[model samples]
Target: MTAAEGQSGTTGAREDERPALLRMRAITKTFPGVRALENVDLDVRPGEIHAVCGENGAGKSTLMKVVSGVHPHGSYEGEMLFDGEPVAFRDIRASERRGVVIIHQELALVPYLSLAENIFLGNENSHRGVISWNETMRRAGELLRRVGLPDPPRTRVADIGVGRQQLVEIAKALSKHVRLLVLDEPTAALNDEDSRNLLELIKQLRDEGITCILISHKLNEIRRVADRVTVLRDGRTIETLTVRENPGDEPQLSEERIIRGMVGRDLDQRFPSRSRYEGADAGELALRVTGWTVRHPIDQQRRVVEDASLTVRRGEIVGLAGLMGAGRTELAMSLFGRSYGRYEAGSVHVSGEEVTTRTVTDAVSHGIAYVTEDRKTYGLNLIDSINRNVSLPSLSSLARRGVVDAHAERRVAERFRASMNIKAPTVAEHVGRLSGGNQQKVVLSKWIHADPQILILDEPTRGIDVGAKFEIYTVIDQLAARGKAVLFISSELPELLGMCDRIYTMAAGRVTGEIDRADATQESLMRRMTVDRS
Candidate 1:
């Protein structure tokens, strides 16, 4: 079929008046016992940003895999057309040959390699069998400039921050001459400033006539750059809504509308409402840290957390708010068994008793549980079963003479699975097979089973969808209601404002300010977060 013929058939009454650059019809993918996608249809026009929105298990990534050739042709039932021509890709390289490239949430770059080398690792600048270093550096420099990364091509990727690493991933994609760029949760790990810069770069790419497929849980970001959004629910395409007609046009999409299609229900509230706890009326202090100082583990001369002090009262959810590199995670990690850095000086008190938490075991024994921000890395063991992961922290309780009671462990896991609403057929299932939201629940269940009087949760709802976020919020509220002092740390200011009783802001390794819920606003928190008292 000719390009013009395909255009005439697909561009009927569309505002953009452009033919679909990519089209999929009757896509169906299935795992051993799971139907991941069922008759999922998607269309993308040239030079437009198309966003795919869905919950954690709604098959967003799976659909992208199908497009990117991660799931090779004939392994699934689908018909895909690129540039008005039927295409069947056998591997990622085959997709890349057609200028179709995908960047996953976890960046695929060699840490030890230089920027230029990483950018052209597989698609090297070479003549015959010899690699031309000069040509690679020259092209890498150009690509970096296009992505707004100021770092030199010779710089190692490991030396840079995550935001810069993301840019490098894009530069690598550019090296492949990517026409249809698929980004899965591109800004999930980025700070607000970095996220804005990345979004601006994406807009610039769209202007340069490069089509993009953005898979993100963040609704605001989708509304910002997407021309149209496709919502998938339970592995099926619910509807595709027009966000805007053109790049500079006013958006006609509401978050509520997109969310309704994703979850199949109207979510009246994003954050679950909790009972207010005022001063003096709040319960006794469950956790207190004073004069806490931590030096960087690698650089002993540098301080990551400096003289920080905070308190969390029983039944109260106190928020720790900060920008990236503001020492929020440093402080939490330092307090919890001094896990992160070298504790220079600090005093920890639990329920009016000064305690030493110099080790993880000591911290757990003292009734302090820390739920790490990186659930996949530090929180849960993905290879283990749900029951094993849930009972990990409290193994001693389920053990007799050092032999674990398997029946007791299963009972405990089952209780948490039911209470936390973990969507799994059995606790014997490996945690790796579960979605992001369910994996987070297992992490929480592990920590909660330890029966800690104080819980330090860091970025508990980072990458999950809005519906899953609401469920996580409900769980945190329940923990507080049970008189557990909660120290909630998050990058999102609105979340802290909604869920916290009091918020403490950090800047450059120091606590800058603290405010009550009634008095805190995004502006106030940001001001404190930017104002380094050093």
Candidate 2:
């Protein structure tokens, strides 16, 4: 039987075939006001790369937490079978002891610690309660080589970039003797080259007989490496699909089919249909930056962004396209009044008039709003309520006699929540408890409340699902319809080609090419992106 018919909830394989390495039967989990998972079931064959794709708030993370013992036994009702043996794991350590390891979406490494020390953090290389430094370093080197990381064992985790830290995380998992690995959104923050390397590494591990369960919103990555795919929607298992082993024999799984299963309906277009910008360039300049240069804060001699120039007209959705470390984020932050890096030189103009913005407050007063790429770190206060977050930027307007109007604040928050379609029971819920898509919407809402004529959005839909992406696109179109100058920066070229009126390609801190909507093609953008700038 094919792998597709090899699950309990969806289908089953022939009795003569090998037993599944893991079976999660009738998994039901609940929170105070949410049925996160309801009677969900899954099966994983040994030595296969199984992918789980779902919209945000679809209980993908909850199911993985259950399997990894984050939501321990008795907290949720489920029967788990590992190697066809019934097991109830009391905690994460118990699961790890049985060769089941999970790497969360946010890495769990100590930044100040060295790579070797992080690899064997709690499971150390010790003799008589004394850690053997030599052994730890040797093993760390081997693990690093296994994960294709070239960093030395002595290098601090904080010193490396996000991509390298991810590899080090996998090395840490390897140290635990992982047989079944669960990776949640492994490549969400990665660029093209780094994502390719990580996917290749997952495939390599699968070939070595390690069962992998990958959760990702990127359908292209899922289609690239998944042997079988299981999709969850609204906290329910939709279907299990078998991927074509040989592309020459049969076409791989189509993204359309997966989207249908995920959203429970047909989505004719991945991107919303926007009007073309062939000859529609008559509006006044809404935002303009000229000869913008920023240097690395720690090393003032090293310039990160050099002589970059761009402009956005009124009601225009402009795209900034590049690979990782192309100084896209740095430029955006620097333009938002030196929020990042040391601003060396730049001229900013709003509505065709020069404006002086030296800080975040100054930028806001000058009708500029910047939604950061890392929402958790720089955007929202996770511990605060949603209403508070939404009301933050507009507090001055909502204030009366030096006192905030709580009733008006709540009303404004309610209006935005309804308009954005944020899925939460109440505005009083903490921002941290929400899903990736909802959190992104909240960030946008916060900025929109500021009422900026010019807006900068960096990776607006980075870790969100396709459905959420469509909704975000709709929101952007609405913003543009309201005559806002939107500067959209993303690593996904398809997004730029679909949503933007014009695109500017950045390579090595320089704006290499600019293409109109009609002229923008993935190949053209990529060619400009990889141009030799030395």
Candidate 3:
């Protein structure tokens, strides 16, 4: 349908009169010992931005996969209707052939390929078995322009940032002549500016008569872009709310209402209650890094960190806030036994005693632990069971004569699983099969089980839902209450403001400013985080 047709067909119409471009009827899906979705129904109108909001493990992703044919026809019990025609697809390629495209959270583009090559990866422009490079580049350039990306077609995907890669994904979708686009967690890894740009691009797509289905955990983003929202809870459809259905008395949907539908209760407060530490009278010093400097591992002339110094006091949570690639993770990893960049110079002190942790084992032995940002790569062994992942760090304590006691390991893993509220069938379940939130809890459990007095958490709540974030915050609070020093690093400023006793902003490998909780504001922190390095 053209833009004019879409507007005139459904504009100012009653809810019953408007036509649904897509309908998922009586959908039900199941896994072993799990009913992922139970008789759910959804209706999405043409040219409208429809949002799917739910907590993690709520079956939102499954529904989209079913729609896009990732689950394939006859794999699940459901009927999908597109544009008044019943359709069943056997694979993703079949769905794409009918103009139904899905951009997964983890982008599918090959990093080594050029933007043009990645855009037309499988669907290349060819004439009589000959690939047409000119046609591909021209079409790729047009799609990039439509998505508002300024990068050239020849640019490599690996050389660009994540925000730009997301645009490339959208351009790739457009190349398929997508009539209905489904985006799963599109802005989960993007910063504020990139997220805004992406949302604007979605709106532009909507204006051009393309229908969109957005699955997001951030309620605020959904509210900003969605014309209607479908809320799911525990694999069931709770409600579908229109943005302007009520017409005037009040706004049709609010963030509070969506969250209530998601969590099945009024949150009242997004963050759990916690006591803030006062400066100078907070507590004794627990971990301190003084005169730290690190050079790039590959680039000997470049400095990753220079004379960086920070401290985490007992019973206090200190935050490190910075933009992407501001060297926060590098500093944290370098401090934890020089695990990252080459250590040029540094001094680490734990409880007033200088410590030399030249290796990961030495760092762990010195009562220091690091929960890495990339949990899948550096934190958890995905092929192993949760019990093993949680017990791996503390095996010595559960071992006798260098042989691990199986019963003792299970006991410790079960205890941490219960205490951390990890939602899994059993501690023996593979970590790879668990949800993102559960995997993070396992990582934390592994580090906490090691009995580290100084814990460094990098992006602890990165890809989880709001409820899971609150639970992790509670865990951090309990740790601080137990007199364990926490060095928290995050790209989210609001999280830092809510949980930290004090905030240190970094930019271009240098600490720009430090503000106490009482004095910190988003503006102040952003100013510090984006200071001109030149």
Candidate 4:
């Protein structure tokens, strides 16, 4: 049977009528000087997809950590029950032994290992203290097929894309014979098609009698698949709403209702108005690229970006839209000091003057700054204080007589902390302790401090919630109001439509089309984005 048919067949009864498969009561978790969760409660029924909705720092992850034993039993104050019996899990292994598995936002698979090895890393198929390779591969192949991954079991995990890697994570969970699967932001980094497939898999698992606890910021996806939603705000349970209505009935929950519960206020407008900047005379040409071409860094012969050209005017927010492998990130990274690929041909102009960006220093010197897509890896140092990270790109300006000036650095960080509304208590706080939204703010502050004329933001709001996205949108508008050229790259088409003055679509390493904001639609942009010139 098809996935949709299976889902429909499983929706005959209200899942709420069933007894709870897992439950938590009055859960309170704390850290040094931070109350992460307080009096939070949750419930999940068997054979249902339960969604957890919350803004960043709303204690969603903390609650899941408590349930999955990442926080352990003695680390917090809570009452938990699984299968009608009280349980205290000391670690992840203990939880897994009870058929409870959690897949974190940051995938835990080893990149260098084969898919089979990574899937069976801890729970190996063995007998007499020896592993059977043939048995392992056979079981791994069955699990992969179950998850719809066609790659060979011997394929290296690193060789596959993130969408397939997510499937592998589910396969790994299945290997443990998981009963309760908790996925935190599973589709946060996925493309539209991959996301749909993953959600279908979640439903398929539900039809097969596995319970799923889904934590996500995408309300639309929740509306699509979730049987019920539990909203958390400020580390407290707000309300639980039924999302799955009777068969052939209208939805009982709306996106606005979920937003209200999440933020404690109505978000009448998701994207802030940029009417003030609309219809204004075009400013000077700030950045221009012509006939840009780049080859794969390792292969040297395969072209990643080919004959691409675009321009951004001062005080304008232009967008780049494309699919996952459409070469949008490659073009942006290549322009930012040839960071991703070998530059074969290109000419860059700043304010109509030709310049060369051969290195990161050169790019910065030419008033260019790029906010990387993978922030945890390339944007900020997690262990460092927010003050240090905010001043990293502009350390030279804060130095006096070849010595770093501590006072100047503090002032800069403090200014950004207040202006950007970073939620940290002090600049001395480690960035790793902050929420996804706050960490993104720190990255923006670092580049804004460099005083760049042109900014390329890649997936700036990738993992943040709606409230935080609005804040980031306001910041971007403010940057454009200050006469800075902003090139926004995002996978969400609605975001591009709302925030950009114009958008350029890329497909197969080539520029497919450019459309003014007045004329752009998701359908039109998608048509261009799928034009595979290669």
Tens digits of lDDT, candidate 3, 1-534: 223211211235465687889999989998776788899899898988899978877888889999999998898998899988999989999899888999987678898999999999999999998999999999999999887788899999976656578889989988888999999988766667667888888888888899999998777777788888888888998877776443122335677777777898878877778855444535989998887889887677888787888988988899999886677888998887789889988799998999998899889988999998778778999999999999988888999999999999999999988999887778888888777778999999999888899999998987778888898999999888788899999877889999999999888888888899999999999999999875
The TM-score leader among the candidates is 2
Score residue 276 of candidate 1 by CA lDDT: 49
Across residues 282-344, which tens digit of lDDT does each residue of candidate 4 receive? 578999999999998767888889999999998899999988778888999999998987999
Clashing pairs in 3: none
Name the candidate, 1 or 2, with the larger lDDT value.
1
Cα-based lDDT for every prediction: 0.88, 0.88, 0.85, 0.88
TM values, all candidates:
0.92, 0.94, 0.89, 0.93
Off by over 4 Å in 2: 1-9, 245-252, 275-282
Task: Please list all clashing residue pairs in model 4, or write none if there are none.
Answer: none
- Candidate 2 per-residue lDDT, tens place, 1-534, comes to 333333324444542286788899999999878899999999888888889988999999999999999999999987999988998999999999889999988788898999999999999999999999999999999999988888899999976766678888889998888899999988887878778988988988888889999999999888888877898999999888876553223425677778878898879998887743333544779999999999987778888899999999878999999887788998999988789788888899998899988898899999999998888878999999999999898899999998999999888888989999898888988999899899999999999988899999999998899999999999898888778889999988899998999999999988998999899899999999998787
> What global local distance difference test value does model 3 have?
0.85
Residue 444, model 1, lDDT: 93
What candidate 3 gets wrong by more than 4 Å, as runs, is 1-13, 109-116, 125-167, 245-251, 275-282, 295-302
lDDT of 3 at 419: 94
Which ranges of candidate 1 are over 4 A from the true structure? 1-12, 15-17, 112-117, 126-164, 276-282
Residue 233, model 1, lDDT: 90
Which scores better on TM-score, 2 or 3?
A: 2
**Which ten contiguous residues of candidate 3 have the minimum total lDDT?**
1-10
Root mean square deviation (Cα) for candidate 3: 4.9
